[model samples]
Target: MPDLATFQREMRKAMVAGGVPSTTLEGAVVSDTLPAERRIRVHQNNYRESLCRALMSLFPVARVFVGEQFIKGVFAKYIAREPPCEAVLSHYGAGLPDFLAEFAPVCQVPYLRDIIRLEWAIHSLQLVEEFGNALSADGTPRLSPNVRLVDSDYPILNLWMAGTGQIPPEAVSLKAGGQCALVTLSGGEVRLAALDSAQRQTALRIEAGEPVEGDSLTMLTEMGAVDFHAG
Candidate 1:
């Protein structure tokens, strides 16, 4: 018989990988009378279900765009290709934006990937801000509770706002061009604000792993940032 630690590790692998049972323990091992394979099936279903729920919560607008079947397919592929590495399941769908970019089926809907990226940012910001009490001086919050920065060639703000019922229904024309937005939590509420040229430049600099401070803002302004705000 394998030791307890080995048994647990093997069980976890079998549960996630969907293969023949490796342990000798019967159905009694998993609190079910079904055969080991069936029990494993249940585990598989549970795992996929949990992941789907997480994705849905993070990207409801994306879900609406792709519909149910396509989303299920995406979730299935995501689980098989990129299983959760960290204990926190919120981080599981972080790769979804890149996946959508490469996914051939949704290539025509280019804005879809950017929309998912925005949603993921919001989800992550909410989780992080909830845990840390980081605050700026004079009681002014430094990082918004939800960090939703949009860096896309597509009009993600319009699509997201339309999906969430913030924009009028008739205003959401498919032909609308691309735009960038920043979703942040201000005064304990989530707010989606449009990003100006300067902010976009700053975001680009920060995303490139460059330090964004005084000189960076100056460079951004020189690079054609019409209306720069000091935040």
Candidate 2:
């Protein structure tokens, strides 16, 4: 008899891989109405479908761009390659951006990976709690905890906003060049704004725990990207 740990490992592999049950698992699953292999298949399908739904929800923009069947296929492979290790699905697809980067089918749409990266940033903002006051008594600048910086070699913001119908299609051009953005959550809504080179540098410096000054700070402050605190 396989130990409980060994059985769990095999069960996870069987469920995610969606292959014939290993002999050990087949022998272990005692069933009456369905054979052990058939029962395993049922569970496998359910698990795969659930994970597929999770991935779709996490990257809805990606879904709209890639189509349901194609995204599902890519997700199926991702699930097989990187099975969920935790019960919380909110953070489950963190690796998806990198996975898409190397995925051969996605090569034709090179910017797709950057789109996923932006989507993940937006998704992550949902978990950050709102902090009070961007400025403290001492006037040191403190960025909102919900703020995230995403720099892409593609016009990801234009593409994303255009694709979601938030902006006119004519407003976007693939040749319009790369973009940097500050993604933040406010009043329970996610917001994204393009940042210029100087603002991007200031944001990166803030993230790296470095001091920043000058017009960049003013720009970030006006955009509600920072608060003055005495940190």
Which candidate should be chosen as best, given lDDT against the real structure?
A: 2
Instruction: Give the residue spans of candidate 2 off by over 4 A.
Output: 1-5, 30-34, 134-143, 168-170
Q: Write the per-residue lDDT of candidate 1 for residues 31-142, one digit (tens) a residue.
A: 4466666766677688878888877777888877778888778877777777888878777898987777778888766778888888887777666643233333443212
Clashes of 2: 6
- Model 1 residue 162 CA deviation (Å) reads 1.6
TM-score of each: 0.72, 0.86
lDDT of 2 by residue, 25-137 (tens): 99998878888899889899999999999998888888777788988999999999998999999989999988887789998788888888898999888886876555555
Quality of model 2 by C-alpha lDDT: 0.85
Error of 2 at 174 (Å): 0.9
Give Cα distance to truth, residue 65, candidate 2, Å. Answer: 1.6
Cα lDDT of all candidates, in order? 0.67, 0.85
TM-score quality measure for candidate 1: 0.72
